[model samples]
Target: MKPIPLQRRPRGKKPLWREYAEALAVALVLALVIRTFVVQAFKIPSESMLETLLVGDHLLASKFAYGIKLPFTDTYLYKGDEPARGDIIIFRYPNDPSVDYIKRIIGVPGDVIEVRDKQLYRNGQPVRESYIRHTDPTGREPLRDNYAPVTVPPGKYFVMGDNRDNSLDSRFWGFVDKSAIKAKAWRIYWSWGGLDDIRWSRIGKKLL
Candidate 1:
């Protein structure tokens, strides 16, 4: 007598809800990874940065530009190059770690910086900042216009907003620790004016 062939069992399909849930979980993980180590989005909420980063502008920052910091901690897993002068960076406010601030790197570690008559001097040489804007051209405050020279401490940076006349920056708050820095501003992804006025021209513009 011939031997009977054995039948194979068909695989069962996953439930629709389960499939959707799996997809959603995957998406969330990917987003978290990107935000933590690759890049992240931020909105400009103040006019301190002005022409360089206008209020209501949505931008992307490169988290890996300087290094990869461990999530929920200031420790870095992979160290990168130090932030260079002129780099626009997002960092934790020194006074309040819960708040984030964006500013341009004016002085890196060990650089001598000063503000004389509202002009920035680095290492005793005048810095010509074409992007610098003054909302009140004639207005002058003692510390705002004439800050005494100071050396940026090791593992720290001196930062200032592009809107020199109105910004409260390193001249007021002191240096930003390297561990507080999060990312470098990469590009403007979106922007809007008062109410419904969308700034179409600023979208996709690269931040200097």
Candidate 2:
């Protein structure tokens, strides 16, 4: 007797729903990785940055500019170059780590910083800050107008906002530690001036 022949069953394709779910999961993972290690989107919430970064401006910050800090931790996987003076950076607020602040690097490690009559002096030389904006011309707050010189300790950065007169910065709080720095502000991706008013001109502008 001949052996009975067996018929093979056809294999069915994967469900469309499963494929879509897998694709969505992959996209979400990629976005999270990018946000944690590469670049992240942030929106300006106050007038602290003013003309440089207006309120309602959405910007992207390069997380790897200084180093790749482990997400939710201060430790870095690979330490990058030190932040340079005048480089705009995003860091955790020294006084309150829960909040984030963006400002220009005014003084780096070992640099002497002082504000004399609203003029900034670094390392005994006057800094030429063409980007600085003064909303109040006659305001003479002691710390705002004439700050006593202080040497920035190692691993700390002295930062200040472009809107000098209105900004509460290193002068008021303290220096930002290197480990607290998260990223560098790269460019303005989107901006809205007011209700239904998109700031087209400010879009794509690079932040210093």
Candidate 3:
């Protein structure tokens, strides 16, 4: 008797749409991961950082510069370097956590900060700030020009904008808690002034 022929099963394949969907899902997850733990992008909404950062400037911020925090929480997974003086950072607004703000760290914990006649002083000595600009250098506003010395409390930081005269910063609000800080400004990736204007010089510029 002739031997019976064996039956063969065909290999299964995923639908084209399913393969595309899977690829897209992976891409989105990677983007979210990078945004949460590596870096993020921001745009300059105002002239608060003038000359230093202009309106419409798009920049990248290093989220891991401070620490790797758990998603949607203040708890850190891996603690990183602390914010130092002169470091520009993005943080949640103290008065309104729903809002985000950007400013430079002027004083760290236990630091005494003051301003006299438009001059910034830290620890009773004049702090050199070549990047700061004074739109109203002669303005006599007490808070803007002659602020009384105050110590930055522990786990808090005193921050200010590069545009000394026009910015509403720590002098107007209060200290930024360490937990509220989000990321450090890294570099400018793109800049647009208007429909027909692009700030070519600002592109690729590093944030000091």
Candidate 4:
């Protein structure tokens, strides 16, 4: 008599630990990419910008507004639109490459920017600033008239700290180039006046 064949046992599923590890690794890599090419977080380090942006104000930056950039190259794969005056911009300081400074674009390419007394004149016309707090105005930069007829060179930008008085800006150093810009600030996402304290009302504040 022939012996009956034995039934084969089924194989058990692989351990869940392997799957969890793989998922975690992928998540971390994705986060890094997003941080580099997409939105980035920035915190104001000084009060150079007062009412517009205060110290410790956290903000979101849109890198794609300009164009996409390679991970570690100075070359621009895609040339994007140029910046305009009155836009708040984030750019690498021309004199100091290691520093990233944020300021408003007061003058664009081929625009004449100058200040008389404590008032500002753009291209022979005055810029009406209603947001500034006139309490103890810092006054205009000294010898500002000497720098008049400043035609913004192509591919360059003029930046200024909102505080106006204490800021080291284009008036002091020089113009910021198109390549130096990192992103355009959009809004105040979160704020902390002190420890364990968060100001919720400041969230979603649109930047000018």
Candidate 5:
């Protein structure tokens, strides 16, 4: 009797489970890369930005706006353009690196920053800020309303919140180093005041 022909297994074909796992792994890697170097999302936990960005606002920040940083570290892999004044940035809190904060860049290196009676002055010139919100105009706080003029050091940036009356920013902590900046606020993807208050007007709004 002739022996049955030997069955030949398919060559270079992966098992279905393996294929799925490989796909999942690739997806995870891509997501990590994107989050680390491309863009990231953050929720507004406080009214630091006020009219510009409200609490409960979910926004996307461009991680590559300043440069590409090494994954899991503040070191830059390929240094690119630096952040400029008026750019809203998310950065590691200088006082506590474990915490992150968001604020607008008010003074670049060598810039003189001061606040007199709640009016911001850069380089001894009053800045025109149409986005700032002052809830208490008559209130007087030493660092909040009247700050001594100080020149920003090299590689350091002075940042502050639009809600000048209630924000704890560079004026309170210290200058945020360039390396601490992680991303630049790009656009608002979602916003809501509460369960019953979805801010439709704020959604998709671009941050200046």
Candidate 6:
């Protein structure tokens, strides 16, 4: 015999607050997953990478670009990729992991990076930074007040801001350990304020 269908209990009226809370919880979890191993959003806070990355510009950083690290932990969750030269990246400040900073990776593991009069030399050759909008044609100038030649330790990187004149980066703090890297900035998805007004042809374009 065919089983009789169970009688349905009278449907209870659900409070809208419960639905809202459930939705919010799901959103938070999704955000955490994305930030942990997919893509993350970051805002440029300074002009250090100007002409390349500007303040108030919103960019998407990919977790898979380098690899995934355990969220809120130092453990390595995965090592799926490696960073390439000229990549704009976001990382926890070496001095303070609580604070995140963005810059371009200039020197990779084992690279001997030095600055000679604002010119970047990697392994005894001048790095070609044609991406720069302008530099003095007469001669190279010191990008920062301080000067030092840093030998990138194995498994570490030397990062600098594109706006050499304005950023407080490796020159000030020190090299960024590979573990400190968070993501590779790949695209400019959004912008805000006055920066939005100066719409260059490259705005909203992929990071080169």
The better candidate by lDDT, 1 or 2, is 1
> Which residue pairs show backbone clashes in model 4?
none
TM-score of 4: 0.84
List model 3 lDDT by residue over 113-194, tens digit each: 9999999999999999999998896679978888999999999999999999989999988899999999999999999989
For every model shown, the clashing-pair count is 0, 0, 0, 0, 0, 1
State the lDDT of candidate 1 residue by residue for 90-145, as single tens digits: 99999999999999999998899998888899999999998999887777788789
Q: Compared to the true structure, candidate 2 yields what TM-score?
A: 0.92
TM per prediction:
0.94, 0.92, 0.94, 0.84, 0.90, 0.81
lDDT digits (tens) for residues 26-77 of candidate 5: 9999998999889999999998889888889999999888888666676778
lDDT of 2 by residue, 42-128 (tens): 999988877888999999999998888777777779788789999999999988899999999999999999999899999999999
The Cα local distance difference test for each model comes to: 0.92, 0.91, 0.94, 0.80, 0.92, 0.79
Better structure of 4 and 6 per lDDT: 4
Measured by TM-score, how close is model 1 to the native structure?
0.94
Candidate 3 residue-pair clash tally: 0
State in Å the error of residue 73, model 3.
4.1
Q: How many collisions between residues are there in candidate 2?
A: 0
What candidate 4 gets wrong by more than 4 Å, as runs, is 1-17, 73-80, 133-147
lDDT of 4 by residue, 1-208 (tens): 9999998898887689988998999999998887877888999888767778877789998887788778778766666656877788888889988998999998988888887765678899988876543333644446432355577889899887776666778888889998899998888998877787777877889898
Using lDDT as the measure, name the better of candidate 2 and candidate 6.
Answer: 2
lDDT of 3: 0.94
lDDT winner: 3
lDDT of 4 at 77: 66
lDDT of 6: 0.79
Worst 10 residues of 2 by lDDT: 67-76
Q: What is the C-alpha RMSD of each candidate to the true structure, in Å?
A: 1.5, 2.3, 1.9, 3.6, 3.2, 3.4
**Regions more than 4 Å wrong, model 5:** 1-8, 72-77
